[model samples]
Target: MPLPEFNLYPDFNTVRLSHAYLNVSDLAASKAFYCDTLGLQITDESETHVYLRAMEERGHHCLVLQKSDAPGTVDAVGFKTYDEADLDRAEAWFQAQGRPTQWVIRPYQGRTLLTSDNLGIPLEFYHKMDRLPSIHQKYALYNGVKPLRIDHFNCFSPDVDASVAFYNSMGFRVTEYTEDEDSKRLWAAWMHRKGGVHDMAFTNGTGPRLHHVAFWVPTPLNIIDLLDLMATTGYVDNIERGPGRHGISNAFFLYVLDPDGHRIEIYCSDYQTVDPDLEPIKWDLTDPQRQTLWGAPAPKSWFEHGTRFTDAETRDSDIAASPIIAP
Candidate 1:
């Protein structure tokens, strides 16, 4: 399929994938996994919610855990804007596109615009977040894998082409993409606002589900260290896949399931994508190395499973689309 016309979309001046909100059945267990096991620091906490940030983060939180009856569900995927006006622009932009939108006041965040993408994935946009002290140099506070910061989010969409076009209209540049060999239909796309390989990725799958939220580790060895920690901590079964390099982004990664089955990825070593004239890299869907540089295939669960997202206004699970993997 041809790419979307970039001129048709308004540029809302998005900064990056700043944070993600997740619903966990047990806040304590989720805290233990994220804070103790993953080495993220808790910024604030309550009975129902806990806010966390990475060691290198200055933002109040990069991840929020909200206590809920439903496990493995996402409340929303969030993005940062360049300024307060950008939030207003985003609100107007979503409304112009005929998508339902709401203004929300979140704790420790400035005015937020809540809306859904073309695929109905819940999204949050904000210009400011409360700042916290960075612990990047504090070795004493480090534990477990000690991830640096949030890198990106991978979401499943029934229609990759449509999702890509929607994101393209939002000023997200495609860095890489996968297409079916026989049909040449788009199977997946990696998009970015922060000039890395991707700030968000859309894969052809059952619709409107979160595949995984990735955090950047300092090095490849950190990925190995994380696997070791998981093995020693009696949470070895949660180690779902990898300590492998992806041919697409050139990122070394490991995917693990949290206590509530929310998938999180430990990632490192992706190249910068800041050049304006850089052409997006493309891959054939059938290429073995596309998924893993070393040729190991992703597990069925990795391809087939993802966490469902909740509607921002109704607070109910959004309807998911049927799976559509290419044969």
Candidate 2:
């Protein structure tokens, strides 16, 4: 099947992927992982919550950790629109599709719209956020891999093809995708708006689980430093996979689990995909190197495990295929 046409004139303009809300078992532990180890600056914090922003991000926050008894549940992944008018347009767009939405009061954000996609992945869309001075040049404040910005989010989609088609309608273009050879179906896709590989990616797996939230780091050296830090610290066991390249995006990566088992990827070096006409790069499901161009095979947990979406109902997916896995 051919890729869907890019929606040039959608009802609203979504600028790029924004923040993610997650529930953590312990605020102190999660803080150590994100702010101390991962190099995200704590923008604000309270007794029950902490907001974090990357070094280069001017937004109030890119990730929010909420202390909860039921840890490992993701509240929502988010995106930003062009302006307040676009937020209004977005509300109409979702309402047109009969998707329920709510205007919620969020700290440091203006008029947040809480909604979901056709697959029921919880999403938050907003246009306004408080800004902060850049701390990119603050050498002394740097810690762990020194992540520069939020890169993308990958989700476990029960139906990859459907996920691609749906996001395609919202103006997210396909940069690359993995195909199921026997079925000739899309097994995974890297869809983007901000253009460095992907702002979002979907992998066929169980329904509505977040595969990993990725952050762009300075270089491959950062991954090496992070590995050393994890080994010396108490988090050597948190390394899930990588310190390798992905054939699909050509990005070097390292995946680690947070205290709550929420997956985080330190990534860099993916090529651009800004041109709307750019054809999608395709990989067969059977390609071993597609996942790791050079490294040990990914553990089974990398494929089968992910952060569950809060209050989202799960269902079995109809499409099925067997792909390569680590022994």
Candidate 3:
């Protein structure tokens, strides 16, 4: 089925993916993985939580780790809007659809609206965050991959078509997608509010789990350097996949597991998508190159494992649903 017309929900103008909230069992261990090893800078921290950002980020944080006894899980995926009114528009639109919504006062952030997507993935919308000095030129402070900024998030949804439609209504444009070869059913989509390929993507999978949150490294060699650092630091087992190119986005990428088992990707070399008339690139699900340009198959774990998200208000695990498999 074709995607619903764009702007189905009027005045919903999301700017970009801003941050991802994760529940981790050990804050210290996660800090070591994300900060010391991955090169993210610690912006703020408390006994129960830590806020981190990449070198190029002006915002206070792009990733938040909250202390929890449960296994590592995603708490929410956050997006920034053009202004505070855009967040109000989103809240009203979601309420009109009968989705539960709440206003939250988060530290270092302006007024926030928390809601769940159709698939029950926790979503947050906000307009303001505390700004910090960019550390891109601070070469002496760089370490590991020396990631520049948080790039994108890949999430799992049982219904890819519905997820695409939901985000499309929120002004996200599809830059690339995959569909079943025979049935032509939507399997996955890369959507964006920013100029690059995708600020967020949805893949065909179980429930509202998080596949990975990506950080933009300066170059492909940065990915290699991180691998070397990981190996030297006895974190070789954390390497999950690639320093390979993806035919879909044409990005050089590497995926690794943090100490809490949450996945993060170090990515580089993707083109911008600023043309309004740009047609979305489509791929057949059976095409190996759709996922990897170098013909490397993704591991079974990559397909089956992802961090579950918790409900924003109730703090309960979102129920997993069966995926719509292509015939």
How do the predictions measure up, each by TM-score?
A: 0.94, 0.98, 0.93
For residues 1-327, write the lDDT of model 1, one tens digit per residue. 876644324558888999999999999999999998998999999999999999889999999999998878898999999889998888888998889899998999989999999878889999888887768999999888878999999998777888888888888988899877555578889998888999999887777889999999898988888888899998999999898999999999999999999999999999999875578898877788888988887887987788988852222222233222323
Q: What local distance difference test score does each model get?
A: 0.86, 0.89, 0.85
Q: Write the per-residue lDDT of candidate 2 for residues 1-327, one digit (tens) a residue.
A: 566787867778888999999999999999999988899999999999999999999999999999998899999999999888988888888888778889988899999999998789988999999999989998888899998999999998888888888898788888888877777788889998887789999988887899999999999999999999999999999998888999889999999999999999999998988777888888877788888887356788888898889988776556677667889
Give the runs in model 1 whose Cα sits over 4 Å from its true position. Answer: 5-9, 312-327
What is the alpha-carbon lDDT for the whole of candidate 3?
0.85
Best-performing candidate as measured by TM-score: 2
Clashing pairs in 3: none
**Per-residue lDDT of model 3, residues 1-327, tens digit only:** 675554523567888999998999889988999999999999999999999999989999999999987757887889999888898889899998778899998889999999988878888999999988878898998997998999999987777887898788778888998876555568789988889999989877676789999999989999998999999998999999988999999999999999888999999999999876578998877677877897777887787778888752222223243222222
TM-score of 3: 0.93
- Write down the TM-score for model 1: 0.94
In model 2, state the lDDT of residue 245: 93
Candidates 1 and 2: which is better by TM-score?
2
Deviation from native of the Cα of residue 63 in model 2, angstroms: 0.6
Off by over 4 Å in 3: 312-327
